[model samples]
Target: MGSIEQPEPTVKIPIIDVSGYLAGDPKATAACAAELREACENQGFLQVIGHSVSEATQKKFLDAISRFFALPTEEKEKLSQSNSPCYRGYEKIGGQKLDELDTNATTDQKEGFSIRPERPLGKFLAGPNQWPEESVVPGFKEAYMEYFWAVHSLSKAMFQLMALSLGLDRTYFDAFAADPDGICLCRAHHYPPTPPDAAGRTRGVGAHTDFGALTLLLQDTVGGLEVLHKRTGTWHSVLPVEGAYVCNIGDLMQRWTNNRYRSTMHRVISPLSHTDRYSCAFFNDGALDMMIEALPGCVPEGEKPAYEPLKVEKHIVERYVQSYGAGGTYIEQRA
Candidate 1:
């Protein structure tokens, strides 16, 4: 009899400790930045520890999301993302197709809710979030909003590290980070258990690069995320790291670094276990109008920029439209 095949072990994404950097220690900050440079250049994914977001805070936010996803279909549909012009609300399973490059790709098998800062109306994907009534889930809104700001603060610190990693002043990316027009999106995703007959036709999320500058992800221990190793053309599982956020650069970052830093492809498979999986992803895409071009130190001495400069929002909107179709259209037909 032939032996049974075993699943590949989870790959070890580089881990970095940044507590000292957060405390304004120049030496620790420099060391942290150096490690960041290596991870960005090679794997484009890393685990961040010592970020100081308490486990209680993380649990509160995730618990809120789990409660929201546990609602009945009819109740959830009332806050459907389709009703919002900016696409900020509950997204039903299969609402997005991330692997658009694949001719045979099917819709993703996940449900989610997206939230952005409650900015004034009149901007693309900017406006009030769709929240469930406090009666239904007391403190749900508060929990998520608190986490949003916490992660936002961490993202600014990350941008500073990224700038330093490129051999530029740590403040080189500050303007972009502080721009009010920057898009900071947070999402709660729930991947239900895979059907027995799914047969690999669906994914929790498909293989694709993120559309923004950086992504900070918090995932549960069920573990289905995988990253594509560009060098070897193989996929490896990304196991959960306790008390750490899994961070990765996105396409815009790749553009800014002239591809010196990679934007690796990643995807999630539906968990085969009876248990469900959940994740929270925060995307820190810089200012809408910021130009994406090679940074001063990112380009080689004689090589021209590999990518033409493009506005951050334009690139993001195009990618959203491609994935979300009419659901991704801007409110009031305004770009």
Candidate 2:
């Protein structure tokens, strides 16, 4: 039988107020910070409301996602997975990584477009991003380019919350994430309808933890996001809370905190209904060249850093290729 989503206190994910953060109010920001700490530690995930991005920006991004997905298969294939250097461009279902797959796994059922922006000063952190010429999807490039900056702005505020929640100066993560050459991708995804009652078969994006610092997901009205509760080890559907972006810790965050935090597993089950599923995820990451070491505040007395510091960019690439089947294929690989 198909399961209906229920509100479970078995896990308490926060729904933070970003009003103060947006208004530049210090005290309100502090309150939100404390709420964030509880959410991160207790649930490792949360819903964010009051983020400064206006409804129009949200709509434009959505329009871009919907437009890209609406294109005919023949057109999308022009910028096939094989054509891109750093694994950017249009990828059909089963093109990149599937769940539970190693370096090479059978392609899964899903299609997506990945965009990782170039730094302003003529430097590339991610493998080169391969974009289709504007002719392919009129204004796709223009809309996406603008969207990246706005998402970056939201992510920076998120990082500050993370820093404060961990008992550090607000700028603690600034140096690490600034101009990161990391795989900070804007992944626009679509999962077509699936068997309506295929009880517990599989999902559009099978169970997996993202390979970055934070993931800011903007989901359409037709929602299918679910998370694995760390405490009970049970699954729960995050009901589609309109105008609220879901934020969750990624694998790297858990490693950096030595498990004080968690990178919970999540997935998108293809909807049983016959509607196309559209969602945009801003996967915030740093430069692969930057090392991710344990934060001093997270390390307990006599407890050493759980994982050795590794370059954010390289570590993520290895995992991406290992997870999705696209590594070092997008852009020119940097040292």
Report the number of the highest-TM-score candidate.
Answer: 1
Models 1 onward score TM values of: 0.94, 0.87
Model 1, CA-based lDDT: 0.84
lDDT of 1 by residue, 1-335 (tens): 11112235667799999999999999999999999999998999999999968888899999999999999999999999878877788998878878734546667778999998887766677777899999997899999998988888898899998888889988998888756767789999999987777554247787799999889999989888888877876778888987789999999999988889989998886655678899999998877878888889777888899999999878887888777762233334365
What lDDT is reached at residue 266 by model 1?
A: 89
lDDT of 2 by residue, 1-335 (tens): 22434424334457888888768798988888898888878777898998867788778877877887888888888877577555667777876554552333234567888878754323333345666567766777777778777888888888888888888898887765556554578888888877667653336676678888888988888867778887787777777667778999888888778778888787776656778878888887776567778877778898787888877766775776565544223334434
RMSD of each: 3.3, 3.9
Candidate 2: list runs displaced more than 4 Å. 1-12, 101-107, 119-129, 132-136, 180-182, 195-202, 326-335
